[model samples]
Structures are given as structure tokens and as C-alpha cells.
Target: MEIEYQYHFSLPRSVVWKYIKNERVLKNALPGCRSFSMVSNNIYKAEMDIHIGPIQDLFTLEIRLDEDQAPSLIELHIKGNGNMGQLNGQALLMLKENQGTTMLSCKANGQVTGALGLAGKRILDSSANKGLENFFQILEKEIKRRIYELKRRNR
Candidate 1:
């Protein structure tokens, strides 16, 4: 399946890029993301719960951040399995300054198996879209909140 989304952040591109590259920041962005800790230089152990239609799964994601251009572009690769199936994808991210904010465009392509694959194509598409939307919403909120908190501390 192919999934894509675009969003604008209330921060500069450089600052947003730097903040997003951190595993700790990512952990906070996900909904019900209990914990995400870096196990090595580019490997992380992440746990998150996601739902689609009548199906839900607590996903344990092993993520590896590869091919970094640092504060410019990056590739996020994930590999793991859960109640749904083996989930793997590479998210290609490009950030640009839009007006005074940062605009992020991501293209995600991945697949599913097991019970989720048995659900059908329509279910897969809708589920993927909704899951990604929820993820972005939570992620964006966390980013803004953290930045706000950081500024408050500095003040």
C-alpha cells in the first residue's frame, strides 16, 4: 500500500527537522506510545497501539533511521510484527519553509499480512489512512507542546 500526507508546522524548518530526528520526541508524538527508547545508534524499540474498523493491535516496532542528510531530509525504516502482520515501510520526508512555518511532505509505502491482509483492500486503504492521520495529529501536537514548553523554560 501507498500512503502520503502533508502538514505544516508552527516552527522553522531547521528547528522542526532537528526536533523530529530525536527518538524521544517521536515517542511522544505517537498515540498510546508507551515507550520508545534507542537501543543503539539508529535502532529503537517502540510500542504503540493502533486500530482499524473492528481490528486493533498493539504494535512493537523496531525502527531504524537510515540515510540521514541531517536537518534537511531523512529515511525512516521500520520492521516488526504484531496482531495485524509484519509491518515495514520507508518514509521519505522532505521539509521546506512555507511562509513562516515548515511544510513536511511524506510518502509512505508498506504492506500487511495475517489478519489485516484478510480484511481486504478497502479496509487496508482506509485503515492505513486513518492510522497515519492519527499518528500525525498526535505527533504534531507533541511537537508544538514541547516547543512551547522549551520556550517557557527559557523565558
Candidate 2:
């Protein structure tokens, strides 16, 4: 499956970058995340509970951030397995600054294996497609609220 998402933040690219790199923020904003911890620099171990239709499972995912470009671009490679299936994806993200704000965009491609894959390609694709839309909206709102609080503190 493939997905693309974009969000605009009323903050500088630097501030937005910090949130993306911070483990706590990432964990909290990530949809379905139960626990996420930094395993090594730029690598994180994540535990999440997700459901598609009536099937639900907990997955332990290993996520790596690559293509270091501070405040500008990033690549996320994730792999995981659960009782339901195996999941793997690569997401390329770009951050651009306009005025004093930032626009973040991501393009991702991945696959599902095992039982989850049996959901039929259309079902899997639609689930992921709809999920990304909802996830991005929620994530952007969380970060925006955080940034607003930070900006308030700076005053």
C-alpha cells in the first residue's frame, strides 16, 4: 500500500524538527502507540495495538530514521510482526519552511504479510489509506497545541 500526508505547522522548521526527533513526542502523537522507546540513536522500539475490522493485535515495531537532513528531510524505515501479520514500510518526509511556519509532507510505501494480508489487497489498502488521513490530522493537531504552548512560554 501507499499513502501520502501533509500538515502545516505555525512554527519554525527547527521547532517542528525537534518534536519529530523527540521520543516522547513521537510516542504520544503516534496513533495506536502503547509504548515507544529509543533503542539507539535514531532508532526506536515501538509497541502498538491496532485493529482492522474485527481483527486486533499488538505489534512490536522497530523504526529507524535515516537520511539525516536537519529540519528538512527524513526517511523512516519500519518493520514489525504480530500474530496477525508482518508489516514493513519506508516513508520519505520533507519539511519546508514558509514565512515562519513549516509544511511537512510524507510519502510512504509498505506491505502486509500473513493473516492481515489475507484481507484482500483492496481492504488492506483502504484501511491504511483511511488510517493515514486520520492519523495525520490528529498528529498535526497535537503538535500544533504543543507548539502553541511553547510559544506562549517564550513570551
Best by lDDT: 2
Q: Residues 23-89, candidate 2: write the lDDT tens digits.
A: 8777777779999999998899999987876678999999999857776999999999899999999
- Candidate 1 lDDT over 1-155, as tens digits, reads 78888877778887787767677778878777878999998788998776766878888988887746766677889886787777778888888887878888889888777886777878888877776677667777877887889999999
**Candidate 1: stretches off by over 4 Å:** none
Model 1: lDDT of residue 137: 76
Candidate 2 error regions (>4 Å): 148-155
lDDT of 1 at 97: 84
lDDT against true structure, model 2: 0.84
After superposition on all CA atoms, what RMSD does each candidate show versus the true structure?
A: 1.8, 2.1
Candidate lDDT scores, in order, read: 0.79, 0.84
